[model samples]
Target chain A: MKKVLNLILFLGFTFWCFAQDHVNSENRIANRHCLDCHGQRVYSFVNPDDGSTVRKLMPVDFRVDSALFYTGAHHIFKCVDCHVPEYDSFPHPNQLRFEPMYACLDCHGGDDTYAKYHFETIDEQFQKSVHSPETLNGFTCWNCHDPHSFRINQRTGESIANTIAYDNAVCMKCHFETGSEVMLLLANEKLKPMSVSHDWLPNQELHFRQVRCIECHAAMHDSLLVAHLVSPADSAVKQCKECHSRNTMLLSSWYRFQNIENRNKNGFVNGVLLNEAYVIGASRNEILNILSLILFGLTLGGILVHALFRLKMNKRKRHE
Target chain B: MSEKLYLYPLWLRLWHGLNALFFLTLLVTGISMQYSDIDFPLVRFDLAVTGHNIAGIGITLSYFMFITGNLFTSNGRQYRINIRSLFSDLLAQGRYYLFGIFSKQIPPFPVTLKSKFNPLQRVSYIGAMYVLFPIVAITGWALLFPETIARQAFGYSGTLLTALLHIVMGFFMSIFMIVHVYMCTVGKTPLSNFKSMINGYHEAH
Candidate 1:
């Protein structure tokens, strides 16, 4: 009986492990988003009249056009960069340039010049990212996403680097790693900034996981501006002052606030970046949680001690 | 004492009981929702959050009901705490709880048709109704429907601020629970007020 039970338990565990993968939204034997890699044109919106989703739930249809795809300019790019080797084949290579999220890093090398002093210092922070080493793997600068389209956001004031996906779009794609699409929802709930371990894919709201690290610590690449132009007036300081208000204000001693004399073309310095400020903004609840934990532990321990000791005293008094 | 007659109104009793029940539910479910863990929730995590949301809304509704009932009815007299008598009321109640209660003496403050609650009780109820409850209601509503706050602000900065408020208010409510429970037991009988809450009547035995 014991041997049979152990075998049954083993089989049950294995079955459960596999079952969890299929339990999620995107991992069914069929789902629409898989049609991108599958190459079959008729997969995603199967039976459009009946309005049912079809197609084998293959890898995410990275290039498959969606309604909002046309909202940005870079939507015209071809399938070569994204679909990579799989631009021709079904099973994409693990190390290919188009290999899911990691491939994003391969295409956009960490050192691409968006601006003169593009933030390369984020390498260490990316290694120790909150998404690193626990639920998900530690990320390289490129692992989180490719900086290809700035239709969502351009860190620079100049229209130069158009490479950065919308924040939500970036998170949702990599949300399910090594699991089916349905598991993606569970992954999302687990990824919440205020995840309470038991919260599994909460339908509560989106703000929970929306504020990722890059949303704050975006590269504040430096720019150039002639401080005191003689012939032609410099316009760099006017533009640069927007993001660099604190530092520019501090540095411009002799320069008037309205004077065109000192054109501070510098973008946000490392110290003046709103990344830390935005991060601290999110830290309020985290700090609250820490304080709550301390209070809860103390309250529970005191209550337990009070009850247990009271019980012991009652027993002793009854004996007396 | 037999010569003096005071009749408690029905709406006051109803509003008080509903307020107490909803407040208790909100407190338990609120704590459960905030520090939600598999180890100790009185209900499942999802259900706990739902209950907190519902109970929080219910408490807000109950507060409005209580105040409305008070305003429309003569039971509003219970809220009228005199500043001059405040210290005496507290001393009387404190002394009764400390020493006089064990001697089976009369309660320090007398209950009448107009003034049912002692000064301390009136102050506590006023603070709960006007100050803590409203702050909690606004904060809880904002946190619950953060998408609205996000839209209103046109910036996402308010989400963290709202969540912080929700947690802080939750802490206040949990501490209130300790005091509320202790006060409930200090009634005519240990179970007298608890039973009064159910039947809406307490006779002087």
Candidate 2:
């Protein structure tokens, strides 16, 4: 009886594994079918009324870059997973266009697999940010983070410059005119050019290249990977010491990944930053400072003793 | 009676005075910047930066003047080291300062018309002006225009190493200045050497 039971359980497990693979394969095919029309800039169709060919340009918002989609966090998902099943139909019903969009929490909330991401906490942070739904009429996570192409670059151990560029581009999408038609459609007012707004900053170009826009604009949070609470322009940090001092915010924000990677490495004062550019006052070594102070003190003491001896000798010579 | 020699000319005196002013300005401003604290600042941060930059430029120009003066004038001859007797010359001069001066014995190497510096003075001056000064000046300029510094060097940030090198050189130069000033008093009288720099003459025994 025991032997029969074991055989049945083994077959049952094997069938379940095969079923899972089949489902995944089918989902991938479905995703490809959707991408066939969405990936291209234009698609041709037959206008049945006139029996003529019609070339229709896909709206920018409706289009998706296949390469980016495949690499994104949602690559494993099928087109109908987050989207309505009606989208799977040919000529997707016009009502599907107005279908309520899914927020990040719609799928991630209360899910054990996404618990580590602290998506709930991030949602709370976003609610308090300047870009919150309450503050802006139609603002959502999709405005800054495109669901089609968004990837985690900071923790991927890429160069800080690459990470800065990727993250800053998200803000510049709406803040500056990068010629994206979708941005113009989403924007309520004329975008304030970054160059014009940041004119008062010294070494503006260098600052932009070296750091992310969020470093000053966002409030830092120890629990979150990146700060979501965006501050208003008047509240932004302008003091040089905020970044130049030993307790710089960069250590916690921009350089956090590098810092964690190099925390155990030896032979550097500010080892994290020592691997990249050095910030004055911030990069100072405690050991070096103490050693220099000791040396200076010794030299001064030696000079004082020598001067005293010389004074005594001069007096003796006068007596003679 | 003492024999007088024209060791410092009018131009040399003027340069020496300007160099002293610049060095003092740099030292004060540099300390303020290196150990800057918002609560207890040595000098206002902005002012210190401005002062340091101006002094740095002044010192850089002064260094060029020193190089040109040494190249074109007889003063250049004093810096040339006699490699053959260098060790012996240094020992004798060192001995005089350490023991002989206390006993009122004659100096091992006296200031002469042709030789302005004793062997000990010659070596230290060369190390300061030739080696340390050039390094500090170059690194200062590199810091001012950080784009010139290599992004990385020897598996470390080049800017950090350059900054460390600059600080070390500046520290040594400060020590050298202190010693140089004190040594001036070891002449015929405590004020005699200072007077000569002022009046362009050295009184030799």
Candidate 3:
């Protein structure tokens, strides 16, 4: 009886393991079913009343770029996971729209674990970002980063040069490319004209290659992680003196974050850092400069007056 | 008889002349480099950098010559400060410049074989040579090798700190030059001190 009971227990365990595998395999099969139609179908319509032809959601446009999707950070997820249980059905509903079918906040909002995993504060930061419009209109994450192909930057082990490249690439997708069609639709008149002539800047190529555009363009702060508010091109820092100065805006980001302890200790006493390259009229001790200037003016003035007085006295003496 | 003293030796005269020339050159080139983008143009940006670096080297060499020559001769004694009498001597010198000099009173501290500088001159010279020159040179070199100063070793950025020190020192140097030229005119004859620097002869009582 003991041997029979042990054999039965082992069988039950095997069945449970098989069930778990079946469920995972089922998700994959369901995703493939949805992709098969989405990959090939191009829904077309003709208006009989106006005798007009229209095309909507062509397979070329609607279909996921399989090559990108397979290798993307989201590749681990099946279609149903984000599309929800409503999308598990075959051929989807005839009048189904993907926009109302799924929302990004379903899993992302309200949970600490998801927030940490995503490195996203969602609405808290996005609302205050430069892109936020006066009305309830602005860019979603999908505008810049495609949901199907979004990848997390591996900043921890990457070299500084590589990290900078990765971050800038996102902006350059629109900014660097000449006559970006997507930019026209999204940014419209708000797009800042690219500075084609960098005549004022020295080593322009070196600066563009190494530094992120956000470094100078963003608002000043101790932590770069939260300073996402980008200034418009007109208001952006174009002056060399700003960075070249002792109290540079460059110190507000990466350098500041890296040297947090030192910054905290020295502090910005007079809008100047004591232990950094001092900029004239920027970061150096202002009191010392003022005192020295006063002394210089007084001494030089005194010398001139004394010389004039002596010359007048000498003339009087010589005449007598 | 108006006695003429052979005060400035040949080496001292040569060192002084070279120091003045190189310092003026450095000042001009530095300003050019600093505001290279601006409308003012004493030299082209690249040329200004080259000239500044060359002038800096020349100043460094002249400075070393002055130090070596002074170490081997009595000229070094002129800069030696008597800490005890420094404040009082400075006050007396200040008073003379303010009142006594105009009234035709004899200078309390006169230039002689042992004492070429008054108390004020000795203090200013020491500060300029030992404190200012070293700082300017070191900081200027720090900017040249940005990688070395870029890293934060201590609590602050070495590059920035060095730059600040360099600018401040340069300011003091400018003031020193202005005052030194003016004080040179305070000799028995305005041209006498200028002639002494060139020909090694000064008017003496």
Candidate 4:
């Protein structure tokens, strides 16, 4: 009985040690993510022209936490795989701007990185798009998804899954209502093309679908830095291109602002600074024409009859 | 003694009366078609459609009759568009009604057997004959079957676009009807023009 008891005690001790080791192994990379704000010294390199190039010393830096490496499918990637230039000094990016943003092919471009199979044609098309080279809000897979905190446990409220749920709210911020409706006059034929081309969204979709208007079209701006903004706050203005692709007379946001200033000096100005009416007024007039026709029957029926009667009696005399 | 000369011929009278009747049918049936919400035993869709089609056929056929009659008649010269004469004739007619008629003076443009229509009547009649009515007919025909066109052209066929086009054209016609009614008040008497149409005669009193 004493020998059996001793055996049990030894097995229990071993089990406890194994459990302790597993807990310690779980925390491979503890805490890492991008910093919300760069410190004052980081802004010390702003030229105000290009709005690029910055130097060290920020309170926060946006980072990919090492703790996530073990949990996510990205456990396949190394620390330097995404932040290419900062591979050596990952836990602390020694150089400030060396952490390049969203280069898809750099790690995956070659023979080994699945570029040979999964994304060969798509990558080519993506590179050719207006969104290429950082024009389109630099849309990367990261823009739509958060890799590590993709799914959450319902009961515990813990985000642990790897499948990324899409976040469209990220786009809604820029495209809320930048369009100047131009002066749509009910139903003018001249304004038909402009009005017909525009897809007016229903009120319900604004709340539920939350689809940004500019997702497909080009963003309204001269450049990224000095982009003249109607409302720097709402997403509707710039994000219309998200789906629309067509804003002719292609004045950038900066030029429109310039145009607004010229108009203001001439003693005429709209608050939003574009009169969509000029573009669509002809179409409104066309609708009015149709209205005129409807009223024609009411007002002219008697006159037509009088003329017809005169014509009829003349014909009768000729027959006689 | 007043001029009791006959101004209209037999064929013209027949054509005019039939045209007037067709217009009435069209007006009644067209209104019913627009406001389908109103229920009447006589105003079913098939009945309205039959009336409308007959009217449409009458209007189209009469269009030819009027054109040929206008071309062959000696009174055709009265319909010539002399821009200088047109402006003066319009003013003379306007003044006679506004100042002369209220003053009970003799009318400015007298009705003659040789020139049945005054300048104002001539131009408006021409527009109705040439431009306005044709638009309604062509657009109406197209709107009646938009799917056939859309199917042949776009490959996807549906009534949505056709219905929208029909409604739009219908609205224009309604607007024209309102303006047409107001102008009838401008005649020799409020019902003078009305009487003339029904009787095929205008006594230059």
Over 4 Å off, model 2: A1-31, A34-63, A88-90, A110-117, A177-193, A251-257, A265-274, B1-4, B10-14, B188-199, B203-205
What is the Cα-based lDDT of residue B149 in candidate 2? 84
* DockQ for candidate 2: 0.34
Residue B190 error, candidate 1, Å: 1.7
| Model 3 stretches with alpha carbons more than 4 Å out | A1-270, A274-292, B31-45, B153-155
Report how far residue A2 has shifted in candidate 2, in Å: 54
Q: Model 3: per-residue lDDT, tens digit, A1-320?
A: 99999999999999999886674565456667666546444544466679686555644446675446655667667886676565655345765574453345665677786655443444444556666554225566565567676665532333345656767777777676364655666667434445563445654555675567777666754423434566655677776545544456656655454344444655655224443333322344556657877988898887789888888877877887
Better of 2 and 4 by TM-score: 2
Interface RMSD of 3: 5.1
Place model 3 in a CAPRI quality band: incorrect
User: How far is A48's C-alpha from truth in model 1 (Å)?
Assistant: 47
**lDDT string, candidate 4, A200-273, tens digits:** 43223321232222222324433321211212123343222212212322233322443455446443433122
- Say which candidate scores most in DockQ: 2
DockQ of 3: 0.16
Instruction: Give the interface-residue alpha carbon RMSD of model 2.
Output: 2.3
lDDT of 2 by residue, A1-320 (tens): 99999999999999999887674566668888788788879977777789898888988878988788877777778877778888877767988778898899998898999886778888988999888888777889898888888888855776666787888888877776434554455545565567777776765777886778888998988777678989888899887667766667777764765766655554345564365646665566778789988988998898899889988988888898
Q: After superposition, how far is residue A122 of candidate 4 from its true place, in Å?
A: 35
Provide the clash count, candidate 3: 5
Instruction: Name the lDDT of candidate 4.
Output: 0.46
Q: Quote the positional error of residue A236 for candidate 3 in Å.
A: 16
